[model samples]
Target: MKTTLTSLVAALVLAGCASVGTVDPAQLPQAPAAYKAQSANGAAALTASWWQPFADPVLDDLVARAMAANTSVQAAANRLAQARAALGGAEASRLPQVGLAAGAGRSSTPGQPVPQPATQYNAGLSLAYELDLGGRLLHERNAAALDVLSREQLLADARLLVQANVARGYLALRALDAEREIVRGTVAAYGETLSLTEKRARAGDVADLDLARVRAELAANEAEALALDRRRLELETALAVLLGEPASNFRLAPTAWATALPAVPAGLPSELLQRRPDLAAARSQLQAAQARVGVAQAAWWPSLSLTAQGGGVSNELSNLLRSGAGTWGVGLLAALPIFDGGRREAGVNTAKAQLDGSAIAFREQFLLALKDVEDQLGALTLLQQQGEANARAVSAASQALKLSDTRYRNGLVSQLELLDARRSELANKRAALQVRSAQYQATVGLIRALGGGWSSDAGVKLAGV
Candidate 1:
């Protein structure tokens, strides 16, 4: 009866000891149900190869090359492999460690006229296991497993970033190409205007000052065209670096302006939460930190280790395995912390602090994701409106230039008026192209905000955490 009471008391004490730190995820802030942009029922779904929707074969090829050769992508893959190996190591702690040992040695006595000689041989297998009665080993394994998931998700995130960057670079290149064409056209028009003005001056129909102004305009246009060429070359070199090639060895064909941007679907909140690798990584890190807390708390409890060894020994190496010349033993040891200069307590405190830090980080990530989605949605909407406005402006500017040229031929407008109209028309056309470029960039930003072409099923398969 007394023994039963003692067991009950011990069980109650251990139960009290087990409840140290607690974290309730429900207490954390929740993510919004949907992004600011609402899609129609026919909204397109996001694909892993999202950049392909632009239909730029060059961009498609570039993304493929970057995935295969980019240094950052390779580094993320290596990190994932390392995480997997570390998780395996953590799991190994749960099983018994067994080893075999064999040895032979001879000893002699000193300070004797006739030396006393002895020989010994031994061979045995030793087994040791630390019983995880409090689930410390399992918790540590759980933490390591979560770390592996975080790393794999991080790898996915890295790939997504590379794809988005390639798409952006491709779009910028095309936008610059359009601008260059506009500048070249302006240069040609200005050269014609300068010739007309010089011919009029030589005939005494216009003053020499008019010819000088036209020539100055021609020089300015030529300089602008040269600047555009420099910018385009710089973009080309940047793209080559992204593709892991030398700048001199890489080239891109002219940009494809006719390609349509890919439309993305508005997935349900549940799917979005699961698809965003960064969010998943944050959650995994939190779980890992939680497990670490348990591991730290377990340090306060006594540890039980079981060790056993059985082997044969003989005076001669030949009889090392003989049954009669054998020795065997087993040990059950318990270790309780006596004194460690406050190291263990400090560890526990550090783990608790880390748990708090992880919780804050997870919440911060969710907030940032929400903000990104909203910002991109607003940006896409405004960019589309701006693109339409730019188109109308380009059309009006073209009409004004045509009318001005006709007026100049009829002697109703000055040559300067014609020149101004032509320059305005050229600037307006380039601005229109910039609007289209902005729309493409906005689409890319929205895709990135939505977590970059992830599939729920794929996320589940690749990141089982």
Candidate 2:
């Protein structure tokens, strides 16, 4: 009766020895039904080639090159390979281990040596299998697998970020191109005006002050054109770095902006949460932490292993494998630490703390994902409205410039008035271009926030704790 009672208590102790973790994801906030931003039902769906929707063949090529050569993308892939290797090691540990041993030694009793030194030859095949009574191996393997998954998602995230950055940099560079064109065009027009003003002043048809003002305006516009070129060069150098090429030898020629601006459709919020690689990575890390916590707790329990050895020993090497000289043995090992200061408890506590940290990190990543999508959505919606308004402003300013120029030449308006009209026209045109550029960037941003691309069926199931 006492033996039965003791066995029951031991069984109970082992059953409750280990756990995944204390995190209850159910207690965390849930994903909303739909996004709180403007969305279209007729928008094109997302594809694996996220940048292709821009419709710029050049952008498509750049993204492909960066994916293949970008340093950050390469680094992430390397980390994933390492994690896979670790997972293989963990899996190997779950199987039986076999080893072969061989040795030859010479020995002699100081005064009792018969002929010479005695030679001993021994060889053995040994096998060991640990029974997962404490579930340590299982938890360790689980943790390693989760780590591999986490690495995969992290790699995805790295690629997504690089892709987004390239699109952003390229779009901004193109915007600069468009802006530079406008500045140069304005400068040329101002040059013509300055020439006419000089002629009028020499013929006594206009004041010298008017000619001086035109010259000042021409110089200022020329300076602005030069400034735009300098900015363009800076952008090109940075893009070269993104493509994993040295800035010194890399150059991106100013090309016509033919990229399409497709409206991003808002999909189900649940789908968004699942498709985000960063969120998936955070979830995998959290699950791995929970598995590690179980592994740490398992340290407090006894480990049971079965071992077997078959061998032969003989003074003559030739007879080492003979039946008469053969030997065999088997054993079952159970180990429980009597004492190790407070290390085991400390390890368990550390694991629990890590689990807690991972849970918080997962929640933070989830919330951030939502915020990112919302930010881009809001920006795109407002930019669309702003672009319409800017276009009207540019139109009005252009008309005002034409009137001012005609009146100034007809001697009905001052030179200052003409200059002011030119300034307003230039500013309004630049503002419109900036708005267009922002709309492109925000569209890309929205795509990235929606997990680098959109797909109706994209979903990632988080590992249960």
Candidate 3:
């Protein structure tokens, strides 16, 4: 009998190991060799802290603060902790459970002898464990471990997104500041032009119509400046919220614009699978789903469990300590499903459907990641060209405004022509500011799309904690 039992245990162990399913990495879709929209000059590798390239200390501080205090990031961290705890519980389920019990009770029977009441006292230790002959427990534990990893990746992704949002907000605020300054300068220039036109009109060298035009131009420039101020206030308030502060209590002083554009390297697309935290999370989820499928499949087999209890019982409390009163027993229980009204089949089908959904989600995430990088690359390339052209236009407009001013003073051109030149110069300068703003926005966008740098192994290291 002993030899037969040993052989049966060994066979079950081998069969359990053989029954576990495997997932092939090659079964997943492949990435392209190169990005279609990557620029020739975008060969510089990105660093872990991609925002540092902008050389803005305030921006760096804002991003750090947001990561630490943002509500969304905090929520993600909490979810990660929950996943870790769940994994601990799943692992514990796979091990033997030992419990101690002690109790005292009194009972009476109506049809018993004269001493019908009796007192009972008991103390015991109990042990129970699943044999895991079908690998069900192991598969569940594996799935839970993968779930923890998925939550970790999700937390990292949240941090990445928060950092990107802070950078974008800060850069936009700075761009608005720069644009406001340009408008202010234009308003001042228009004021001086109005003064000169009024003097010319008083000296009978200019008509009343010319004076009215100058006044109208001044009013328009002033209105534009006011509009810019309103926008700046709105942007400042929004940025304060991103910093996790009340808008009324937060303020950012006007400062020099940092429009430095960082070059991002277009690495092999396959590397994205590792570098992108969202993709990493998706892959982890897929692994967990695959493990759950195995668990469901294992349900078709029988479950084996072992239980044991050792204790002492007696009518007298002192007698309970005596070895003669001791009681001990062991048991081996096997539960085989004969008929469950198709419950097992439904469970297997559900697990398979979930596995299929996870697989598709992972593929979709990969494709979206590729699209993000390509879109940013295209924006960066086109914005660079636009910036160069805007610079040239600003310079030419300035020269034309100067020539028109001199011609109007000499009566060689009408006041309308001079006003037109001024408007053109201002428009060109404002357009140039917009182009610079777009370039900064695109640069930050590219950094975000590239998974906030190439630090593929960068993650929340909570191992010791």
Candidate 4:
């Protein structure tokens, strides 16, 4: 009987290794060797501070402030803290629990001993520990720890999003500033042409219709400048929100758009699984779900626990500590679910479903990450080509405007012709600014898609603000 009991205990100990679910990174979908839209190869890996490549100090400052103060970022940080606390709680559960108890009471016997009253005092220390016979506690702790990891990755993702938003906003603002200047320059040129036409009309060298046309063009140019101003204000206010400041107190002075576009290396598709925080978070969540399945499976097995209590009781408080009044007890308890009407089976099924869902979610995340990189790469490539064409168009339009102005002054062309040339030049210039702005935006997007930079060692770091 002794040998049989020992064998039974050993088998129960081995059963603790059983798990209901498993996750294999290798089982995940594989990535392609190269992105279809990639135009370059063998570039350096992105840095953790991806925005620094823009070479704009102001943009760098804005990104830092957003990461530090953005509401979403703060919320993620709080969640990470909560997950850490939960893991701590789960770990603490695996250790023995000890408690102290003390009480004093008075009681009276109603039907015996002449209705005498009695006083009692007692103090005791109690201990209890679950034996983890089927690895339930271990699986629970593992799940909690994975939850903490998931939250940490989510926080990193939040920071990456904030940084990308700041960069985009700043780039748009700069582009609008450039467009505003172009409109203002066009308005001034039209004003000069209108003045020249007025002088010619007074000298009877030009018709009233010509003067009217120049005046109309001048008014339209001024209106366009005004519209640009309104758009600039709107973008400024939006940026203020991104920076976590009141719009009334925040302002960005107009500056030249000199931001550099950083080249992003299109690494292997597998690298994305490691670099992207969202992917990492998804992976952790899947692991946590698998661990929970183990927990559920363990519920079908018996739970074993140990308990002990030592105490002393006496009628006198002073004698409570006496050895003669002492009492001690110890116990080993095992509980097996005798009847729960399929509750345990239901729990197992639920856990299995959750695990399946998590695996699907992880695959979806991976696919989306791949799509994100591809989209950004395609945009950057197209935008670069468009920018080159726009630059050429701007140069040609500028030359045409200069020639038309000379012809109008020499009385060889109508004021309307000169006005058309000026408008064309301004439109081309604004279009060029827009193309450049889009390049910057796409650069930021690609960086974001690549997981907000790379590290040589342990993937991206979440420490830098």
lDDT of each: 0.79, 0.86, 0.80, 0.83
Query: Best by TM-score, which number?
Result: 2
Over the stretch 1-465, how does candidate 2's per-residue lDDT look in tens digits?
A: 999767755754664474557678585556777778856545767677778878998888888889889999999999999999999999999999999999999997577647477999999999999998778899999999999999999998999999999999999999999999999999998998998898888899988888888999999999999999999999998888889998999878887787898776645455565678888898889889988988988887777899999999999999999998899999999877646887877888899999888988888888888888889888987888899999999999999999999998898988899999999999999999999999999988887888866675543445555
Those runs of model 2 whose alpha carbons end farther than 4 Å from true positions after fitting are 1-18, 110-115, 266-270, 458-465
lDDT of 4 at 298: 85
Q: Which candidate number would show the highest lDDT if scored against the true structure?
A: 2
lDDT-based ranking: 2, 4, 3, 1
Better of 2 and 4 by TM-score: 2
The 10-residue segment with the lowest total lDDT in model 1: 456-465
- Name the lDDT of candidate 1: 0.79
Instruction: Give the TM-score of each candidate.
Output: 0.91, 0.94, 0.89, 0.90
lDDT of 3 at 33: 75
Ten consecutive residues with minimal summed lDDT in candidate 4?
456-465
